[model samples]
Target: MEYASNASDGTQIAYTVVGSGPPLLMVHGSFLTHTIWRTFGYVKALRGSRQLILIDSRGHGRSDKPHTPDAYAMTNIVGDLTAVLDAVGVSAVDYLGYSFGARAGLALTAATPDRVRSLAVGGGSHGAQAGAFDRLFFPGCADVLEQSGMEGFLEAWSSHRMFPIDSGTRAVFSANDAQAMAAYIRASDADSGLPDEVLQHFTQPSLFYVGSEDRIRLGDTRTAAALVPDSELHIIRGFDHATTMAASEEVLAHLERFWDN
Candidate 1:
Protein backbone atom coordinates (compact mmCIF):
# COMPACT_ATOMS: atom_id res chain seq x y z
CA MET A 1 0.00 0.00 0.00
CA GLU A 2 1.08 3.61 -0.68
CA TYR A 3 1.74 6.09 2.11
CA ALA A 4 2.13 9.85 2.18
CA SER A 5 4.91 11.92 3.67
CA ASN A 6 4.84 15.70 3.87
CA ALA A 7 7.96 17.38 2.61
CA SER A 8 9.49 20.38 4.33
CA ASP A 9 7.69 22.59 1.87
CA GLY A 10 4.38 20.89 2.60
CA THR A 11 4.25 18.95 -0.66
CA GLN A 12 3.04 15.41 -0.12
CA ILE A 13 5.32 12.68 -1.44
CA ALA A 14 3.91 9.23 -2.17
CA TYR A 15 5.78 6.03 -1.42
CA THR A 16 5.39 2.30 -0.80
CA VAL A 17 7.25 -0.33 1.17
CA VAL A 18 7.48 -3.98 0.23
CA GLY A 19 9.41 -7.16 1.11
CA SER A 20 11.40 -7.61 4.34
CA GLY A 21 15.13 -7.32 4.79
CA PRO A 22 17.70 -4.55 4.57
CA PRO A 23 15.80 -1.62 3.15
CA LEU A 24 16.68 -0.46 -0.37
CA LEU A 25 15.25 2.85 -1.44
CA MET A 26 14.73 2.98 -5.22
CA VAL A 27 14.25 6.28 -7.02
CA HIS A 28 13.24 6.39 -10.67
CA GLY A 29 14.40 8.70 -13.45
CA SER A 30 12.42 11.61 -14.84
CA PHE A 31 9.33 11.03 -16.96
CA LEU A 32 8.79 7.78 -15.05
CA THR A 33 7.11 6.90 -11.79
CA HIS A 34 8.19 4.75 -8.83
CA THR A 35 6.25 1.89 -10.44
CA ILE A 36 8.91 1.67 -13.12
CA TRP A 37 10.79 -0.52 -10.67
CA ARG A 38 7.97 -3.04 -10.91
CA THR A 39 7.41 -2.69 -14.67
CA PHE A 40 11.12 -3.03 -15.36
CA GLY A 41 11.50 -6.09 -13.08
CA TYR A 42 13.81 -4.62 -10.43
CA VAL A 43 11.11 -4.97 -7.77
CA LYS A 44 10.51 -8.64 -8.60
CA ALA A 45 14.22 -9.45 -8.65
CA LEU A 46 15.20 -7.66 -5.42
CA ARG A 47 12.00 -7.75 -3.36
CA GLY A 48 12.63 -11.16 -1.85
CA SER A 49 16.12 -10.28 -0.71
CA ARG A 50 15.61 -6.68 0.39
CA GLN A 51 12.86 -4.46 1.71
CA LEU A 52 12.14 -2.04 -1.13
CA ILE A 53 11.26 1.61 -0.53
CA LEU A 54 9.84 2.96 -3.76
CA ILE A 55 9.17 6.70 -3.94
CA ASP A 56 7.41 8.91 -6.44
CA SER A 57 9.32 12.15 -6.71
CA ARG A 58 7.30 15.31 -6.17
CA GLY A 59 6.22 16.03 -9.71
CA HIS A 60 5.51 12.53 -10.89
CA GLY A 61 3.40 9.44 -10.13
CA ARG A 62 1.04 9.73 -7.19
CA SER A 63 3.14 12.52 -5.69
CA ASP A 64 1.99 16.12 -5.70
CA LYS A 65 2.32 17.60 -9.18
CA PRO A 66 3.68 21.06 -8.57
CA HIS A 67 4.02 23.17 -11.71
CA THR A 68 6.38 25.80 -10.38
CA PRO A 69 10.07 25.36 -10.96
CA ASP A 70 10.97 26.57 -7.48
CA ALA A 71 8.89 23.79 -5.97
CA TYR A 72 11.34 21.25 -7.41
CA ALA A 73 14.53 22.83 -6.20
CA MET A 74 17.17 20.21 -5.41
CA THR A 75 16.93 20.97 -1.69
CA ASN A 76 13.21 20.27 -1.75
CA ILE A 77 13.77 17.05 -3.62
CA VAL A 78 16.27 15.89 -1.03
CA GLY A 79 13.90 16.95 1.71
CA ASP A 80 11.20 14.84 0.11
CA LEU A 81 13.39 11.73 0.38
CA THR A 82 14.30 12.43 3.99
CA ALA A 83 10.68 13.15 4.83
CA VAL A 84 9.58 9.82 3.41
CA LEU A 85 12.27 7.96 5.32
CA ASP A 86 11.36 9.70 8.57
CA ALA A 87 7.71 8.82 8.10
CA VAL A 88 8.58 5.17 7.44
CA GLY A 89 10.93 5.13 10.44
CA VAL A 90 13.84 3.91 8.33
CA SER A 91 16.95 5.48 9.79
CA ALA A 92 19.18 4.64 6.88
CA VAL A 93 18.89 2.60 3.70
CA ASP A 94 20.88 1.21 0.83
CA TYR A 95 19.90 3.68 -1.86
CA LEU A 96 19.58 3.12 -5.62
CA GLY A 97 18.75 5.91 -8.05
CA TYR A 98 18.80 6.03 -11.84
CA SER A 99 19.23 8.94 -14.28
CA PHE A 100 17.55 12.00 -12.83
CA GLY A 101 17.05 10.11 -9.61
CA ALA A 102 20.76 9.35 -9.58
CA ARG A 103 21.63 13.01 -9.61
CA ALA A 104 19.20 13.62 -6.77
CA GLY A 105 20.78 10.75 -4.86
CA LEU A 106 24.18 12.35 -5.21
CA ALA A 107 22.93 15.58 -3.70
CA LEU A 108 21.13 13.69 -0.93
CA THR A 109 24.26 11.78 -0.02
CA ALA A 110 26.31 14.96 -0.03
CA ALA A 111 23.85 16.69 2.24
CA THR A 112 23.17 13.81 4.62
CA PRO A 113 25.58 10.92 4.20
CA ASP A 114 24.48 9.41 7.48
CA ARG A 115 21.08 8.57 6.06
CA VAL A 116 22.37 6.41 3.23
CA ARG A 117 24.24 3.22 4.00
CA SER A 118 25.39 2.70 0.42
CA LEU A 119 24.85 4.54 -2.83
CA ALA A 120 24.13 3.15 -6.29
CA VAL A 121 23.88 5.68 -9.09
CA GLY A 122 23.04 4.72 -12.70
CA GLY A 123 23.10 6.93 -15.82
CA GLY A 124 24.05 9.90 -13.59
CA SER A 125 26.87 12.38 -13.24
CA HIS A 126 28.74 14.63 -10.84
CA GLY A 127 28.87 17.89 -12.76
CA ALA A 128 27.35 21.31 -12.37
CA GLN A 129 24.13 22.35 -14.07
CA ALA A 130 24.90 21.92 -17.78
CA GLY A 131 21.58 21.95 -19.57
CA ALA A 132 21.57 18.14 -19.57
CA PHE A 133 18.00 17.81 -20.76
CA ASP A 134 18.82 19.98 -23.72
CA ARG A 135 21.60 17.64 -24.68
CA LEU A 136 19.93 14.39 -23.54
CA PHE A 137 16.75 14.92 -25.46
CA PHE A 138 17.16 17.91 -27.73
CA PRO A 139 17.96 21.58 -27.59
CA GLY A 140 15.02 23.40 -26.00
CA CYS A 141 13.42 20.11 -24.97
CA ALA A 142 12.16 21.70 -21.77
CA ASP A 143 10.56 24.37 -23.91
CA VAL A 144 8.96 21.64 -25.96
CA LEU A 145 7.55 20.10 -22.81
CA GLU A 146 6.13 23.42 -21.66
CA GLN A 147 4.70 24.52 -25.01
CA SER A 148 3.69 21.24 -26.58
CA GLY A 149 3.16 19.05 -23.52
CA MET A 150 4.04 15.39 -22.88
CA GLU A 151 2.75 14.24 -26.25
CA GLY A 152 5.19 16.50 -28.03
CA PHE A 153 8.09 15.53 -25.83
CA LEU A 154 7.31 11.82 -26.24
CA GLU A 155 7.11 12.18 -30.01
CA ALA A 156 10.60 13.66 -29.96
CA TRP A 157 11.75 11.11 -27.42
CA SER A 158 10.42 8.17 -29.44
CA SER A 159 12.48 9.23 -32.43
CA HIS A 160 15.72 8.78 -30.49
CA ARG A 161 14.93 5.35 -29.04
CA MET A 162 17.11 2.35 -29.89
CA PHE A 163 14.23 -0.08 -29.31
CA PRO A 164 10.46 0.06 -29.49
CA ILE A 165 8.66 1.00 -26.27
CA ASP A 166 6.11 -1.48 -24.96
CA SER A 167 2.48 -0.40 -24.76
CA GLY A 168 2.54 -0.25 -20.97
CA THR A 169 5.61 1.94 -21.03
CA ARG A 170 3.96 4.24 -23.51
CA ALA A 171 0.94 4.49 -21.25
CA VAL A 172 3.14 5.58 -18.38
CA PHE A 173 4.79 8.18 -20.53
CA SER A 174 1.41 9.37 -21.71
CA ALA A 175 0.13 9.81 -18.18
CA ASN A 176 2.69 12.43 -17.16
CA ASP A 177 1.71 16.03 -16.42
CA ALA A 178 3.80 17.94 -18.92
CA GLN A 179 3.91 21.29 -17.15
CA ALA A 180 5.01 19.66 -13.93
CA MET A 181 7.65 17.68 -15.80
CA ALA A 182 8.87 20.85 -17.43
CA ALA A 183 9.19 22.49 -14.04
CA TYR A 184 11.06 19.49 -12.67
CA ILE A 185 13.42 19.45 -15.61
CA ARG A 186 13.99 23.17 -15.43
CA ALA A 187 14.68 23.09 -11.71
CA SER A 188 17.06 20.20 -12.15
CA ASP A 189 18.89 22.00 -14.92
CA ALA A 190 19.49 24.85 -12.53
CA ASP A 191 21.01 22.54 -9.93
CA SER A 192 24.71 22.69 -9.22
CA GLY A 193 25.59 19.00 -9.08
CA LEU A 194 27.82 17.64 -6.33
CA PRO A 195 31.40 18.81 -6.51
CA ASP A 196 34.25 16.30 -6.95
CA GLU A 197 35.61 17.25 -3.54
CA VAL A 198 32.32 16.20 -1.95
CA LEU A 199 32.35 12.83 -3.72
CA GLN A 200 35.96 12.16 -2.76
CA HIS A 201 34.81 12.14 0.85
CA PHE A 202 32.00 9.59 0.41
CA THR A 203 32.25 7.08 3.27
CA GLN A 204 29.68 4.56 2.13
CA PRO A 205 30.14 1.83 -0.45
CA SER A 206 29.10 3.22 -3.82
CA LEU A 207 28.38 1.76 -7.26
CA PHE A 208 28.24 3.66 -10.54
CA TYR A 209 27.17 2.14 -13.87
CA VAL A 210 26.25 3.24 -17.37
CA GLY A 211 25.73 1.56 -20.69
CA SER A 212 28.72 1.17 -23.02
CA GLU A 213 26.79 3.02 -25.68
CA ASP A 214 25.48 5.71 -23.38
CA ARG A 215 28.09 8.17 -24.62
CA ILE A 216 26.26 11.09 -23.06
CA ARG A 217 26.78 9.75 -19.54
CA LEU A 218 29.73 7.34 -19.71
CA GLY A 219 32.47 9.88 -19.15
CA ASP A 220 30.71 11.82 -16.40
CA THR A 221 29.54 8.68 -14.62
CA ARG A 222 32.98 7.11 -14.82
CA THR A 223 34.70 10.28 -13.71
CA ALA A 224 32.37 10.59 -10.74
CA ALA A 225 32.82 6.94 -9.78
CA ALA A 226 36.59 7.36 -9.80
CA LEU A 227 36.38 9.94 -7.04
CA VAL A 228 34.84 7.52 -4.54
CA PRO A 229 37.15 5.11 -2.74
CA ASP A 230 36.64 1.46 -3.74
CA SER A 231 33.53 2.20 -5.75
CA GLU A 232 32.55 -0.30 -8.44
CA LEU A 233 31.85 0.77 -12.02
CA HIS A 234 30.10 -1.34 -14.67
CA ILE A 235 29.64 -0.62 -18.34
CA ILE A 236 26.76 -2.70 -19.67
CA ARG A 237 27.73 -3.81 -23.15
CA GLY A 238 25.46 -3.16 -26.16
CA PHE A 239 23.11 -0.78 -24.42
CA ASP A 240 22.36 2.94 -24.52
CA HIS A 241 20.47 5.26 -22.19
CA ALA A 242 16.99 3.81 -22.50
CA THR A 243 18.09 0.26 -23.24
CA THR A 244 20.32 0.15 -20.18
CA MET A 245 17.33 -0.05 -17.86
CA ALA A 246 15.42 -2.32 -20.25
CA ALA A 247 18.31 -4.79 -20.11
CA SER A 248 17.19 -5.47 -16.56
CA GLU A 249 18.70 -8.94 -16.19
CA GLU A 250 22.14 -7.79 -17.27
CA VAL A 251 21.91 -4.69 -15.09
CA LEU A 252 20.79 -6.75 -12.08
CA ALA A 253 23.65 -9.22 -12.49
CA HIS A 254 26.15 -6.49 -11.71
CA LEU A 255 23.98 -5.02 -8.94
CA GLU A 256 23.55 -8.40 -7.22
CA ARG A 257 27.28 -8.72 -6.90
CA PHE A 258 27.60 -5.16 -5.69
CA TRP A 259 24.97 -5.69 -3.02
CA ASP A 260 26.55 -8.98 -1.96
CA ASN A 261 30.03 -7.60 -1.46
Candidate 2:
Protein backbone atom coordinates (compact mmCIF):
# COMPACT_ATOMS: atom_id res chain seq x y z
CA MET A 1 0.00 0.00 0.00
CA GLU A 2 1.06 3.59 -0.58
CA TYR A 3 1.51 6.01 2.32
CA ALA A 4 2.51 9.64 2.65
CA SER A 5 4.87 11.16 5.19
CA ASN A 6 5.13 14.90 5.61
CA ALA A 7 8.69 16.13 5.62
CA SER A 8 9.78 18.93 7.99
CA ASP A 9 9.40 21.34 5.08
CA GLY A 10 5.87 20.00 4.38
CA THR A 11 6.71 18.07 1.26
CA GLN A 12 4.74 14.82 1.14
CA ILE A 13 7.06 11.87 0.58
CA ALA A 14 5.48 8.72 -0.84
CA TYR A 15 6.46 5.25 0.30
CA THR A 16 5.36 1.63 0.20
CA VAL A 17 5.90 -1.31 2.55
CA VAL A 18 5.90 -4.98 1.71
CA GLY A 19 7.18 -8.39 2.91
CA SER A 20 7.28 -9.69 6.51
CA GLY A 21 10.71 -9.64 8.07
CA PRO A 22 12.90 -6.91 9.55
CA PRO A 23 12.58 -3.61 7.69
CA LEU A 24 14.99 -2.87 4.85
CA LEU A 25 14.79 0.66 3.51
CA MET A 26 15.46 0.86 -0.21
CA VAL A 27 16.30 4.12 -1.95
CA HIS A 28 16.65 4.62 -5.71
CA GLY A 29 18.94 6.75 -7.84
CA SER A 30 18.11 9.99 -9.65
CA PHE A 31 15.41 9.94 -12.34
CA LEU A 32 14.17 6.66 -10.90
CA THR A 33 11.53 5.72 -8.36
CA HIS A 34 11.20 3.05 -5.68
CA THR A 35 9.51 0.78 -8.22
CA ILE A 36 12.82 0.10 -9.89
CA TRP A 37 13.50 -2.23 -7.00
CA ARG A 38 10.62 -4.34 -8.24
CA THR A 39 11.42 -3.89 -11.92
CA PHE A 40 14.95 -5.11 -11.40
CA GLY A 41 13.86 -8.10 -9.24
CA TYR A 42 15.36 -6.86 -5.96
CA VAL A 43 11.97 -6.82 -4.29
CA LYS A 44 11.28 -10.40 -5.28
CA ALA A 45 14.73 -11.58 -4.29
CA LEU A 46 14.64 -9.88 -0.89
CA ARG A 47 10.98 -9.83 0.18
CA GLY A 48 11.12 -13.39 1.51
CA SER A 49 13.85 -12.38 3.94
CA ARG A 50 13.22 -8.67 4.46
CA GLN A 51 10.29 -6.37 5.00
CA LEU A 52 10.90 -3.82 2.28
CA ILE A 53 10.30 -0.12 2.78
CA LEU A 54 10.53 1.56 -0.58
CA ILE A 55 10.59 5.34 -0.68
CA ASP A 56 10.27 7.83 -3.49
CA SER A 57 12.66 10.69 -2.95
CA ARG A 58 11.40 14.26 -3.29
CA GLY A 59 10.97 15.32 -6.92
CA HIS A 60 10.70 11.71 -8.02
CA GLY A 61 7.97 9.12 -8.27
CA ARG A 62 4.76 10.03 -6.41
CA SER A 63 6.33 12.60 -4.08
CA ASP A 64 5.83 16.36 -4.19
CA LYS A 65 8.08 18.03 -6.77
CA PRO A 66 9.58 21.28 -5.56
CA HIS A 67 11.46 23.51 -8.00
CA THR A 68 13.70 25.45 -5.63
CA PRO A 69 17.33 24.49 -5.02
CA ASP A 70 17.14 24.97 -1.24
CA ALA A 71 14.24 22.54 -1.10
CA TYR A 72 16.58 19.76 -2.26
CA ALA A 73 19.43 20.51 0.11
CA MET A 74 21.14 17.63 1.89
CA THR A 75 19.30 18.54 5.10
CA ASN A 76 15.95 18.38 3.36
CA ILE A 77 16.85 15.15 1.58
CA VAL A 78 17.92 13.60 4.88
CA GLY A 79 14.79 14.96 6.54
CA ASP A 80 12.59 13.27 4.00
CA LEU A 81 14.03 9.85 4.86
CA THR A 82 13.74 10.42 8.58
CA ALA A 83 10.20 11.69 8.21
CA VAL A 84 9.23 8.47 6.48
CA LEU A 85 10.94 6.39 9.15
CA ASP A 86 9.11 8.29 11.87
CA ALA A 87 5.80 7.75 10.15
CA VAL A 88 6.54 4.05 9.68
CA GLY A 89 7.51 3.65 13.35
CA VAL A 90 10.81 1.98 12.49
CA SER A 91 13.55 2.99 14.92
CA ALA A 92 16.33 1.67 12.75
CA VAL A 93 16.57 -0.13 9.43
CA ASP A 94 19.05 -1.81 7.14
CA TYR A 95 19.55 0.46 4.14
CA LEU A 96 20.24 -0.40 0.50
CA GLY A 97 20.81 2.44 -1.90
CA TYR A 98 22.19 3.06 -5.40
CA SER A 99 23.99 5.97 -6.99
CA PHE A 100 22.16 9.11 -5.78
CA GLY A 101 20.46 7.17 -3.04
CA ALA A 102 23.80 5.68 -1.97
CA ARG A 103 25.22 9.12 -1.34
CA ALA A 104 22.16 10.03 0.70
CA GLY A 105 22.70 6.90 2.74
CA LEU A 106 26.21 8.07 3.61
CA ALA A 107 24.91 11.44 4.70
CA LEU A 108 22.07 9.90 6.70
CA THR A 109 24.28 7.39 8.48
CA ALA A 110 26.90 10.02 9.25
CA ALA A 111 24.39 12.47 10.70
CA THR A 112 22.24 9.89 12.47
CA PRO A 113 24.15 6.68 13.04
CA ASP A 114 21.72 5.31 15.59
CA ARG A 115 18.95 5.24 13.01
CA VAL A 116 20.57 2.78 10.59
CA ARG A 117 21.58 -0.74 11.48
CA SER A 118 23.56 -1.44 8.33
CA LEU A 119 24.29 0.20 5.00
CA ALA A 120 24.78 -1.21 1.48
CA VAL A 121 25.85 1.09 -1.32
CA GLY A 122 25.95 0.41 -5.08
CA GLY A 123 27.78 2.58 -7.57
CA GLY A 124 28.51 5.12 -4.84
CA SER A 125 31.26 7.64 -4.31
CA HIS A 126 32.61 9.62 -1.35
CA GLY A 127 33.59 12.91 -3.02
CA ALA A 128 31.72 16.00 -4.16
CA GLN A 129 29.47 14.72 -7.00
CA ALA A 130 29.77 17.58 -9.48
CA GLY A 131 32.67 16.04 -11.36
CA ALA A 132 31.06 12.60 -11.46
CA PHE A 133 27.85 14.11 -12.73
CA ASP A 134 29.76 15.88 -15.45
CA ARG A 135 31.61 12.72 -16.42
CA LEU A 136 28.74 10.23 -16.19
CA PHE A 137 25.72 12.20 -17.25
CA PHE A 138 26.87 15.15 -19.32
CA PRO A 139 29.10 18.12 -18.83
CA GLY A 140 27.14 21.05 -17.37
CA CYS A 141 24.15 18.78 -16.70
CA ALA A 142 22.33 21.42 -14.69
CA ASP A 143 22.66 23.87 -17.54
CA VAL A 144 21.39 21.28 -19.98
CA LEU A 145 18.37 20.63 -17.76
CA GLU A 146 17.61 24.33 -17.42
CA GLN A 147 17.92 24.97 -21.13
CA SER A 148 16.29 21.84 -22.58
CA GLY A 149 14.82 19.94 -19.66
CA MET A 150 14.76 16.11 -19.32
CA GLU A 151 14.45 15.60 -23.03
CA GLY A 152 17.63 17.45 -23.81
CA PHE A 153 19.42 15.93 -20.88
CA LEU A 154 18.46 12.40 -21.91
CA GLU A 155 19.44 13.13 -25.48
CA ALA A 156 22.93 13.94 -24.35
CA TRP A 157 22.96 11.10 -21.81
CA SER A 158 22.18 8.53 -24.50
CA SER A 159 25.63 8.86 -25.97
CA HIS A 160 27.27 7.93 -22.67
CA ARG A 161 25.27 4.73 -22.23
CA MET A 162 26.55 1.31 -23.31
CA PHE A 163 23.05 0.27 -24.31
CA PRO A 164 19.73 1.94 -25.01
CA ILE A 165 17.38 2.42 -22.05
CA ASP A 166 14.31 0.23 -22.29
CA SER A 167 10.99 1.82 -23.25
CA GLY A 168 9.41 1.36 -19.83
CA THR A 169 12.38 2.97 -18.11
CA ARG A 170 12.33 5.76 -20.62
CA ALA A 171 8.69 6.43 -19.82
CA VAL A 172 9.51 6.70 -16.13
CA PHE A 173 12.33 9.10 -16.87
CA SER A 174 10.13 11.24 -19.08
CA ALA A 175 7.53 11.68 -16.34
CA ASN A 176 9.81 13.59 -14.00
CA ASP A 177 9.43 17.37 -13.58
CA ALA A 178 12.45 18.97 -15.23
CA GLN A 179 12.72 21.97 -12.94
CA ALA A 180 12.64 19.87 -9.79
CA MET A 181 15.36 17.62 -11.20
CA ALA A 182 17.47 20.62 -12.09
CA ALA A 183 17.22 21.87 -8.52
CA TYR A 184 18.17 18.45 -7.17
CA ILE A 185 21.25 18.20 -9.39
CA ARG A 186 22.41 21.73 -8.53
CA ALA A 187 21.97 21.16 -4.79
CA SER A 188 23.79 17.82 -4.91
CA ASP A 189 26.70 19.30 -6.84
CA ALA A 190 27.09 22.22 -4.43
CA ASP A 191 27.40 20.10 -1.29
CA SER A 192 30.81 18.83 -0.13
CA GLY A 193 30.78 15.11 0.56
CA LEU A 194 31.25 13.44 3.94
CA PRO A 195 34.67 13.90 5.56
CA ASP A 196 36.87 10.84 6.16
CA GLU A 197 36.60 11.41 9.91
CA VAL A 198 32.88 10.63 9.70
CA LEU A 199 33.43 7.36 7.83
CA GLN A 200 36.27 6.39 10.16
CA HIS A 201 34.02 6.81 13.13
CA PHE A 202 31.02 5.00 11.66
CA THR A 203 30.02 2.00 13.70
CA GLN A 204 27.55 0.20 11.45
CA PRO A 205 28.49 -2.86 9.39
CA SER A 206 28.73 -1.50 5.85
CA LEU A 207 28.98 -2.96 2.36
CA PHE A 208 30.22 -0.93 -0.59
CA TYR A 209 29.97 -2.26 -4.16
CA VAL A 210 30.68 -0.83 -7.56
CA GLY A 211 30.88 -2.44 -10.98
CA SER A 212 34.45 -2.93 -12.10
CA GLU A 213 33.67 -1.03 -15.29
CA ASP A 214 32.17 1.86 -13.33
CA ARG A 215 35.66 3.28 -13.05
CA ILE A 216 34.53 6.73 -12.01
CA ARG A 217 33.27 5.44 -8.65
CA LEU A 218 35.53 2.42 -7.99
CA GLY A 219 38.28 4.38 -6.25
CA ASP A 220 35.92 6.35 -4.05
CA THR A 221 33.93 3.29 -3.11
CA ARG A 222 37.17 1.50 -2.22
CA THR A 223 38.25 4.46 -0.11
CA ALA A 224 34.95 4.50 1.78
CA ALA A 225 35.21 0.78 2.56
CA ALA A 226 38.80 1.17 3.70
CA LEU A 227 37.91 4.07 6.00
CA VAL A 228 34.97 2.35 7.69
CA PRO A 229 36.19 0.16 10.50
CA ASP A 230 33.56 -2.52 9.80
CA SER A 231 33.10 -2.67 6.07
CA GLU A 232 33.39 -4.98 3.04
CA LEU A 233 33.94 -4.17 -0.58
CA HIS A 234 32.64 -6.04 -3.67
CA ILE A 235 33.32 -5.53 -7.33
CA ILE A 236 30.81 -6.92 -9.82
CA ARG A 237 33.35 -8.04 -12.37
CA GLY A 238 32.21 -6.92 -15.84
CA PHE A 239 29.29 -4.58 -15.23
CA ASP A 240 29.16 -0.83 -15.65
CA HIS A 241 27.08 1.67 -13.73
CA ALA A 242 24.18 1.19 -16.13
CA THR A 243 24.25 -2.59 -15.92
CA THR A 244 25.19 -3.10 -12.28
CA MET A 245 21.72 -3.03 -10.77
CA ALA A 246 20.35 -5.13 -13.58
CA ALA A 247 22.55 -7.96 -12.38
CA SER A 248 20.12 -8.42 -9.53
CA GLU A 249 20.82 -12.04 -8.73
CA GLU A 250 24.57 -11.56 -8.47
CA VAL A 251 24.15 -8.46 -6.36
CA LEU A 252 21.66 -10.07 -3.97
CA ALA A 253 23.72 -13.21 -3.48
CA HIS A 254 26.55 -11.10 -2.12
CA LEU A 255 24.19 -8.99 -0.03
CA GLU A 256 22.60 -12.07 1.50
CA ARG A 257 25.96 -13.15 2.85
CA PHE A 258 26.82 -9.66 4.03
CA TRP A 259 23.53 -9.20 5.88
CA ASP A 260 23.68 -12.74 7.23
CA ASN A 261 27.05 -12.18 8.86
Residues 236-256, model 2: lDDT tens digits: 999988778898888999899
lDDT of 1 by residue, 114-158 (tens): 999999989998787668888777778889899999889878777
RMSD of each: 1.9, 1.7
Off by over 4 Å in 1: 156-169
**In lDDT terms, how accurate is model 2?**
0.87
- Structure candidate 2, residue pairs in collision: none
Please provide the root mean square deviation of candidate 1 (C-alpha atoms, Å).
1.9
lDDT measured at residue 89 in model 1 versus the true structure, 0 to 100? 88
Give me the displacement of residue 200 in model 2, in angstroms. Answer: 0.2
Off by over 4 Å in 2: 159-166
Looking at model 1, residue 42 earns an lDDT score of: 95
